[model samples]
Target: MTDDPTPGTRCRACGGAAGTVVLDLGEQPPWDRMPARDAPLPDPAAPLRMWLCAGCGLAQLQTDAAVAEELHGVEPLAMTEQSDRSVGRLARAGLVRPGGRVAEFGSPHGGSWLPRLTGRGMVALDADAVSAAGRADLVVDFYGLLHEPDQADALARRVALLAPGGTLALQLLSLGTVLRDDQWFDLRHGHYGYWSLPALDAALRRHGLGVHRAWWYPLSGGTVLVTARAGAEPDAGTRRLVDEERALAVTEPSGFARLQAAADDTHLLLDWLVAERAAGRTVAAYGAASRAVPLVCRAGLDASLLAAVGDASPAKQGHRMPGSDVPVVSPDELAGLHPDRVLLFLPELLDEVRAALPQVEASGGRWVVLGPGPRAVEPVSALSGC
Candidate 1:
């Protein structure tokens, strides 16, 4: 079959060709809300294709032609939950125990662990660190236009500057994890090299550093955190971690087949909804921004079949659903309008949705869920008024 040209056509992790279909998210404009309301409404860029690689099991968007160049100097993209939790975990793990000087590479704006590390007597480095005014307990500033040689040299410098027994925590993305689980969505253009565990371990050893501990942490879908110290004996944890990684397969061709089977069952419920719509029934949806919405929308239910999208987040309430442009409203708004059918977006958030179902039922609405299968017509007993 001729390969479809898509946003993530090139595997973001290892830069290999992404193969096979994992999901088709349909068209969705940028999921991340623009920084300002007036930030010229980005031209609609939805209906994207997401793929899973058979070779490494990485999941990614298929045709992101404009991403690389436009992404340079984009700092806010660095704000990831992976960095925050990793830094926090390491800080409490005696990595920066009192009086220990530390160094971090690619530490953007010294976000997450840097400020605390500075307080704990550690220094940071970045492009600005080379300036006389750039001195700190830590000193990492942009090296400007980095190559592997530059990275190796800078890391060596940082290691040399560390106080003896002090630790170094480098939080670069791990290609090993991306390959291990095919979490290609975690790969963005900002990062250059895709560091594998063996490759990174070898580099650290060359720089006269020893891996203290390393483990794959699910910070951003998936990531790896490595804590190292200069000249320390290799940690036993590294070997165990590698063995475990090699044991896992990135892709399960059978799993997607199973998911498809489940999806096929879901179509039956969608057919029921269509029949009801043809008979002129009203239905509303709960949990608009969820991935489930795309699946539901793709199933072909019309606007009248899904009256409006309802969400608890005030941030999303008035916004529009990605591809469908279905208007989003509040859960309370659903109660006021009292649509006859309520399709739950997050079936896992069922308890919460169930608890709120009474208000809908009291106002003459019936509950329905398009889940592993679709069924309807009852308020959950969990809520008081139900």
Candidate 2:
């Protein structure tokens, strides 16, 4: 498949200079949404050096590589998994209480939550012409564009479609988080506009909607979940979130530095693992299909040293990790290989995995975690994987 666009140009988000080169991931293919094996792969293109916008602190491409954006199709499954908990929480929090009406912007092929909401009387809307068909009380084509008269008309139509006293919930990535964190990875082609707190509030107000609540949720580093209502003015909650975001200095360089250092430390851990292998110890990687691929690839781990990367996703089992090209398999394979150590890629899943360690121990192995922070190793039977 085609690689990420090279970086050497001005920032598209902030029009700032591309500052210091933070990470230079040479040639690598896309991850997460890789196509089925039979699907034709796009021409390979290496992403040059990725840069940080010193002014806005957004990570961005200097030039468009392949049409990764245009190639993006509705990842309904991914979105459904990511937003299900957020939606359930919002419902419990009264944003979409029983009998409440709602509209989701850029709704992916009728999100899975659409059925859950429809069961409770909520309307689901999609701006993209292409979408997955799912059960919802109402489904409408709604697009989000800027400065376009058509966009204004669509906004009006969506807001008018909402029942009076109903809430409009928005699940959009926060540009403030992306920009401040220099998460250039967030600047994927699929995402067009960056929605800062002010920008989101202004958009809601312009469309005759009032912002009632604005909060941060961790979806791909960070995202903002906002609840709005027609004719309601922007509330203090929105402003408070914006001010707090600023006060927290979420965009400070320190965060990027810390992440970079963490990446470096993960590299050190992988290096140690490779050395251990050279000294005659087998290592099997656990938890495939994670955000750690970029970090692991950047660390230059040997693919052969890894017996097989384990993941629960059937979609990922036969494929390989992006840059490293390590084969992915199911956890059952771990017991077969019987490696001395299993590198836990998903630290969040540690508890569940630890609970299953007694079964995994049939292979007689230990585990290590190369998380976002540092490397920690412990015998599989030691801490219950907590």
Candidate 3:
């Protein structure tokens, strides 16, 4: 609650004060705050800085009141839809079962998953909800624990919520993979902490919990499904994954430098977009994802540069982007537009998008991914033809 902009001096996981500022993304607003068509735009961006903890190696951001205010305006409907698949994944992983009591923390809309978990007791609670302890057979928190200032204490409470042998499953961005690729787009105001396997292991062990099983999914760039239980020993698979993260130097200084280098090169994509427009080539964008908001605002992209932003989601279509006046259209409409080049903001969805838009390839419209290094532009010839 200090007035200082750099709010996280201590490690959120271990309460260590030796956290070092590794990457500074300058000032950023809430990436998901989409202003209404006639509403005034939000302004006065807050400082967005990432720190690496020397004690536990957890990467966290400096959050303050301004950042919190910006995040409060985010629409929950889109985020809720994004979690639908992850909920199913949790069920398939054996975390949710018939006759078991399941509790979901930080669910945008309550009862949205009741239909899916029929015959099973389901209770949806906000992140700050308090209730009787030791109640649930399984507790699922999707990208919520990281937002807490005291993640360790929050996790301990979650552990207490589980019955004996019950599981606490978390779905969050894997810093091990994100740092390796320097996906700066994932670093936003809403997420206060980022976890590598080693860091998460350290935090869980501190609270008398151990990772029993884990899975890596391609959702949200790269996500990790970590299931933990009390009084359970870490299995071989968990140890191997932790060792792999160590080999990657996810928490070391060298890794930070590499990530900074890639982040500094973000302007390369912006310059390429500007040049393409200067040359009179039609440029359109793919994916109206919330993550794309920061990229668009940072790069100063607008309708002038991108003719239209196409998304597969029906909810986002017919709406304009948050900060920019760029229209959000359907992928089908984009095919008919026959743009000369389609820019992909979400590179993780590259294959899926390419497969869905065969007409763009048949019309010789190339696709470009906005990323550092060799992942810049994809030629039309490389795409599968109709």
Candidate 4:
């Protein structure tokens, strides 16, 4: 709860000269700069703060979150499932038209909307290829928009690539959900913007695009699929989403003050882990996700506190959590350890992980979901309820 030490004077989306400090996570290593196992104890730290633009509702990272380098991140099964479901719904809604031209924006996670669209009798074009291939009937961006350093330019380019009356189906982690769930951890270095329905409406209007339809999914706490078309009017569903954001005060920086509590509570995890070690409860963790990087470091954790972190991605397997001595191991190695408690950092992966790691339960070990504090994973996993 202190004001941002490094205040951001300009907004990324609307080029507003001034904005309000929303949430600050102090200084932490960039998520992509994962140190090698034996490299060092502390990596470089940078300001990590979220700012809310008064002119536009967009909340963007005020501090720089530049990538030190590239590290592959495996897409969770939950995301794959959600994509399939999203495509089906979009097609039913007539956005994915037959013989329609589709363009997909870049995503760090390796996957393509091409094959899925081609199978539906739609032509596929990469967002980059749209220049020669001409405008697209539908453009899709999922979790890619926030990575752009220039938010206004990014949106303008994508909207320009759309054909007259074309739709842009954007799926973003709902800012409303982040505020409601207090997911301050999402405020990382590389992620430049957070989108609420109201905020996105303002940003899109700048490019002559208007949101016409919207849908919600449970993936990533909450995800919103918004369909916008040039000069289109907001449908009832879209209006409702904007109204919901207004109710949450999404446009007000002070409204996001709740996030500071989550920032304060992160240290509780370190405390719990320390006490668990003292009590002789063998503890290890799963999911060496980029999201877990700062939490691992800021808590001042090491292999002594957390035995090891398990990740499915082979790229991260040999590398350790950045800024800490904890090693990232394969899921098989993690299972071999059989620690009494396994902290599940990414709670949304609970169902898929449960099916894949039955051995943890079979071996008399229980999975604990990491929240503000640790909570035992019940039969039905729920992040907010936990």
Best by TM-score: 4
Candidate 1 residues 244-343, lDDT tens each?
Answer: 6545422433333333344335467677778878877777877653344445444655455677777766666655554454567777887766787777
Candidate 4, residue 128: the lDDT equals 72
Local distance difference test scores for all models: 0.51, 0.53, 0.69, 0.81
Q: Taking the tens digit of each residue's C-alpha lDDT, what string does model 4 give over 74-113? A: 8888878888988888899887767899888856756656
Instruction: Order the candidate numbers by lDDT, best to worst.
Output: 4, 3, 2, 1
Record all residue pairs in model 2 with backbone atoms less than 3 Å apart, i.e. clashing.
Answer: 7-62, 59-184, 109-131, 109-132, 126-142, 127-142, 180-251, 210-232
Stretches of candidate 3 exceeding 4 Å from the true structure:
1-8, 37-42, 65-94, 107-134, 312-325, 330-336, 354-359, 371-386
Per-residue lDDT tens digits for candidate 3, residues 95-169, read 667677776665321224545555344544433454566377777776667666677877887877777777888
Residue-pair clashes per candidate, as listed? Answer: 30, 8, 0, 1
Could you arrange the candidates by TM-score from highest to lowest?
Answer: 4, 3, 2, 1
lDDT of 1: 0.51
Models 1 onward score TM values of 0.52, 0.65, 0.80, 0.94
Clashing pairs in 4: 65-189
RMSD of 3: 4.8
Select the stronger candidate by TM-score from 1 and 4: 4
Q: Number of the top candidate by lDDT?
A: 4
Report the Cα lDDT for residue 306, model 2: 75
Off by over 4 Å in 1: 1-8, 21-47, 53-56, 65-249, 252-255, 259-266, 275-281, 290-293, 351-358, 361-370, 375-386
